[model samples]
Target: MNKFILIAAVFLLTGCPGPMDPVPQEYPAQARLVDNKVCITVPARAGDKIFSVQFGTESGREIYKTFGQPDQQLPVVQGQCLPTFDFQFKPGERYAAYYKLTNPHTGPGKLFAARFSLEKSENGHLQLKQYSRSEY
Candidate 1:
């Protein structure tokens, strides 16, 4: 009886996940064209930082440059995450934006990439359109 109880206890404990397990972190971001520049916006969280931003053509032929700072920073909420980064890039053409987000508390970072394009409206205005985005 004692041996069976001990085996059952071990199996139950090992089979179930603990409440202290760390949850996977997700970093969501968006991109658009503002005044002929690509503006990348990312939600900010405590201890989370944008490591790098790389811009290139949709074909991935040429990479322009890598940036580390955002052109604008919004206010950080106390307990809520808000869009706090605005990285602007003057591509002057269709391009893709790639970024990496990291957190010290987490083990590794996540990679996010997005492609965008611009179209002229009937009113003779440039409009920004995002093709697709992927997270890895």
Candidate 2:
């Protein structure tokens, strides 16, 4: 009886393994500006929807921002899912694009701090110039 009481007391003190350690957060998708367009890709088929897209240019060209959520997943090209946001860019300038994943199943629906940039090509068209993801 004493042993049973001691074991019960220990179990009470420790507390049942901490509520399953919280469901691991999942990130939905990522994007990059390629060929004057936003190219996005998800780790799984479920995270194909892009909730919001915002852009900034070196010239501060009017600050473009828009929201899009396709009823179905966009077509995959080169294994990367592309969103429908138009990439109207200012020529001969550098710009950054920010993205956020919307679908709940995908991890936290937060805007990734990574910025995708575009630069004017020699031919005077916006092309994928750089990509940066935030460590924080």
Best by lDDT: 1
Q: What number of backbone clashes does candidate 2 have, counting pairs of residues 3 or more apart or in separate chains?
A: 1
TM-scores, all models, native as reference: 0.49, 0.46
| Each prediction's whole-model lDDT (CA) | 0.55, 0.53
Worst 10 residues of 1 by lDDT: 73-82
lDDT of 1 by residue, 51-135 (tens): 6546666445454343345443233333343231343333345766666665667757666566676666778776777764452
How close to the true structure is residue 64 of candidate 1, measured as C-alpha lDDT? 34
lDDT of 1: 0.55
In candidate 1, the residue pairs with backbone N, CA or C atoms under 3 Å apart (3 or more residues apart, or in different chains) clash, namely none
